[model samples]
Target: MYKLSIKKIIRLAAVTLITCSLFSCMSDKSEQSKSFSVQITDKPLTFCNPITLDFGTDRARRAGEAVVAIHQDDYYLFITGLRGYWYSGNMRDWTYVDAPDIPGGCPSVASDGERLIVSGDKSRRDVYASADPKSGVWEKVGYYDREYGDADMFIDDDGRYYMYWGWSQILPFQVVELDPDNGFKEKGKPVTLFFGDYKSHGFERRRPEDVIFSIFSYRDYLPEENPWIEGPWMVKHNGKYYLQYAAIGLELSTYSHGIYVADNPMGPFKYSPHNPLTFKTTGFMVGAGHGSTFHDKNGQLWTIVMIPSFYGGRGSGELALFPTAVDAEGVMHSNTEFGDYPQYYPGIKENAVANNFTGWMLLSNKKYVEVSSTLEGYGPEKAVDEYFLTHWCAATGDPGEYMKVDLGKICDIYAVQVNFDRHDAKLEMGRGFRMPPSLSQYQSYTVEVSGDNENWSMLIDKSNNTVDNRHDYTELAKPVKARYVKLTNVFTHDEGKFAVKDFRIFGNPDVAKFTKVKDIMVVRDPDDPCKAKLLWQPVDGADGYVVRYGIQPDKLYNDYLVYDDYTLDIHSLNRDQEYYFEVEAFDSGTDYFHEKTRQTMGIGAEIELFRDREMLARKMIVEGKNEYVFENIIPGTYQLRHTFGPNMWVGDLTKEQLIGSDNQVTLSEKISDLGVGTKVLGQLNIKVIPGKENGKFVVTLNYDKP
Candidate 1:
């Protein structure tokens, strides 16, 4: 007979108790059936990160330094190297329009309650304006005689215009007032605002863990660690001016944004306590810098930043968006925890504190995958590992090459994001160049779903697409129940291989929510304030945990995702700052809760050590921090059985004090013959460490298990 683990039985009892107590009854059939009815009522309005944009006809498929402007209830998106811009009425669907009059690289846009003014990076001095941006008509309205790197234009409440521009390792950010009445000419000399403080701020340093140093800084000419303070943006909130800029370097994953507040649009400014207003260095999408912020039609604030992808070449990337806000205490910050996951657009959920994350966990991360073919070092598993640096590439860009994901069970699939990476593509144009719209290549594919791995149904069909969509996102018209999802390649752009960085699936499993994570421990290094260690007790039914931390407990804006681990070491923190942390456990599509439905050995049942239904070793239940060593065994599948009794705990209580109950819960589905599949190459040790929970223990299975 198949035996269930003691931990699994206890969790089932806990869920049963909670459910019965909530309803105040257990025998009524109507009450029991109503409890399991669908909890979701509405189709969530959500968007995933690396915000899908019209990547244009660029050979490199890269964009960065994004800026967003709103005019006449419409949103305009401008990015580096694109010949034109994109406009969206609801921020979900964007339409691209060519701007022949405006030059491309690092463009910025600002609206003056009427016409929209646009400008480009350092070398492009000619400025353009459009009364109707959607119509694709722009006129050269102004020009700056002097070159300004990463320039941004701001129009204050009093109709005063100010221009902020600077991008240097040895220069501070500068701002000068512009006279809008006089062809947008400069009205005053540019004032040096501030420079990056790498010594005091560890996040401003140049490397992944903030360990590298640049040549020099503006204050001290001597060789020292320095950072380029670029991409200056301005926003006025409650009579306070918030000047934000990207720091470090664009190539590093730690590239982030910091904020400074002032009373005037161009004046003395102080760094906010929350130094890096936006930071996302640890998730599937990294780098939240060099972006623009704007208010939606519902008055909610949002920021769109650049996420790096240097595969095409250096300085290559896509864009991402996050919900941003300033608290009542005037603290400016952005919520980046699960920033790359599915999130509701503005006004869907009014509470900014809770964030807009749809709670649809990533279903395909590290799950079993099967592909039609693979190139060397580009395995199928890489496509679902939740990291952008790795991908799965088929041997050729053939029409029938496909990638499939096994969700392990039937799940409520809500959305799917397919991130196609450029692998061995024909280089039609180099960096900083745009291809003619007619020459732009298109990607065509079809997404299908299956339940029993044989019969399939179409989910998302883009086989006849004409647009250049690299990071394509599809929110299903209706959520479907599926066990397998497959993406078949109909066409690939530029004769590139069928490569995918991530085939992310979003959904919920048919299981109860995971219990809260407890016994969290944080140890900040006194010798090096930039580093810290976090440890927490593992929670049952959790596929992973998100560590949320920040300067204030109520303002834990930054977060990191840790999978299948109880401990983490963080190195991206400010040296001279204090932070508070909290961890939350989340359930994904691959959780082991499905085992609860499987039939198992009775309570207090002991298994005669078995191998393929044959006795092999003595019978005993290992408990506490004890070691168990089995004698020499053959290379075969072994069933590691466990049993539990009512009120049977594993903690500090003595065996005599434990009370046994008479309940015998029988599950319906029979458990499969699965166990520690291993070869007897060497001695393998399994350890059980008692956890703080009443009847739970941490099991460590050792072997060549990835």
Candidate 2:
């Protein structure tokens, strides 16, 4: 019989301290598959769902217009999230520069060839300057008399300082001359540069919760005619000036940004026909606006923008980076099309961003997995589904817990990104977590691959790694062919339960042909507010269908694969918001599911997102006495189900041993697992001799779905 050391289970238990406080904390495309110009990175950039901007101690999720500045020709990324600055020599690795005096949110900092000027959104336009911004050394230099809106300080080539600011629908993104010596005080009257045209420019219009009315009608405080035109940032490319600015309310999924160009830094700016260059129309994480553009060490142009998060603070939560380029015609274009996906960065001195793509599709996504332990919602699939928010945690906090996958075929493997899910707060609170030693980590692992299912080779060894890169991407210097890959835990960083979100394996399969999906459309179900219908023009020669959907187009966390139908009901979505989905028609049917392509990933089964909200079932052993008492079940009809099997032993329990059941319970034969999705609930106490060997069990309870 199983017993609880802690008699009172912590239901709705607060997420561990890590989840609350650790709010803290990409790619190459190329080749003849090179038909696609975008490149993938060794480290595919995933979405910042629960962004990693949580400061050292203040776990608040808030930030203003993100700023990317080059101080004295050095690349720096600064955000007012908790009012701290991050410095980077190579745009990839960043180090935090301590600046405890900087106020939170809506702060702007800029360099004037020699000095870095900093200002905030407070009533008084007090400014601070630093000769050495790299080290966070600043002293209040001067003050301006007027209280300004969200603004950007600019210094033209000829020692002239200017300020551009405004966000009122009636006002324009105004520009004014400033006196550099006196905190960039206004020297001339502000002139209207551009205005919001909500009527003509649909992106600038404020959406009234009417799109998904039923789900978002609770936003009753929305004011009409409140379109915004603010956050002015300027860039000088070639002989022309590009005036960039953000618009619309932050609440809209379509909140975006656009630009205007002119020959001189000041007058007659022409709006680019390609306005609203940066936007995120659909996804779990929406809106990318109010950002700045700058050059990296390589002089490669990059834009940093604000991305809204359901879990973030006011205005928005996290910042996303998108590489920008000026076309032959000199139109500056910010490539945010695949903004949330993994992207390759510009090399230290390449003329442009070189996408280094290893032609390998996701090889281990949704395939069968075997782990040392799993319980309740922390199922094994959580590690494969690519949802970092969920996880597969070991039942006990023990070392040597491992998860393995059988690829069915010996394939060429190149790279793997190991995303260890930090923590899953049973209780939603906040975050501040330092990885404890008891709940240590895999100090080292003898990552092995095998072809005969018996013989193995050490692919990569981390058996004594002192540094814990919780999210690690190991790009193999040489590709290896293997059918099975196993991550053996040699050690752990802590003594707590071990968990992981996904192990994204990259490798090529045998030759295959895949027909691209055409006319794929996602629309809300006419009869259901919570469901969306994805209809597509079926390809003539196709194996099956695969659909990936997420709030952010870059991170489609939810996926589905259908072998027989052209339609799918997306049952998992927040009614109040829109979602982004991309569909594909594959040539290999479910029979060849093991051979997944870049556009198509295996859809074994996506545990219902709602399941996480429901009461989880207890897991029992294959052969042993099992007693499970779900207290306060609240008197409801329930069904018994299993993860691996409703094994023969289940029938032996008999009627008396089954708790909370009155009628005779019949035992049914089970053939496959993952076929029985949800709506199965129950409580039982059974005993079986140690003879059965083909079953694994983890059960969950929930009300029947309509």
Q: Rate the local accuracy (lDDT) of all candidates.
A: 0.67, 0.53
* Candidate 1 per-residue C-alpha lDDT over 1-706 given as tens digits, one digit per residue, 9 for 90 to 100: 0000010000000000001111111121110111222222344356677765544343335668988877887777788876677777666556677666777878878899889898875787888888887777888888885787898999888888889987988899999998776777898788989988877776777653432222334543334646678898998877889998998766668878888999988789998866777777766777878888776666556777876764542346667877776666877767776678777665454533243666666788777777888898998878987778888999999898999888888889988889887788774324455454444446789999999989999998888766566677776777899999999999987778888989988888355254446678899888888778999988876777777677865566566777758898876677877898777777774743221211143211333334565655543422211223344333343455453323111123222222223222211122222232342211223322222221111222222321
lDDT of 2 by residue, 1-706 (tens): 0000111111110000000010000122211111223222444222222124323222223444778788775566666534456655444445556665554446677788788778865564778887876666677777766766876778888878888777676877778888977666788787877787654454566655512211244556445655778778888776678888887755555556778899877667887654555665532235667888886655567667765533201123455555565655565655443232233443422323223112244566566677877767787766766443456777754557888876657777876656554343232223212222221323356678888868988888877654434345565777898878887666544344566666656566243235546577777765544467778888764545556554444333334445556887654344444567766665421122332221133222112111223433543422111223332222223344444434322223322233433323232233232212353322223221111221222222222321
lDDT of 1: 0.67
What lDDT score goes with residue 265 in model 2? 70
Q: Candidates' TM-scores?
A: 0.74, 0.60
Error of 2 at 652 (Å): 10
Candidate 1 residue runs with Cα over 4 Å from true position: 1-44, 55-60, 208-225, 312-315, 352-355, 428-433, 436-441, 509-515, 592-706
Q: Which 10-residue window of candidate 1 scores lowest in summed lDDT?
A: 9-18
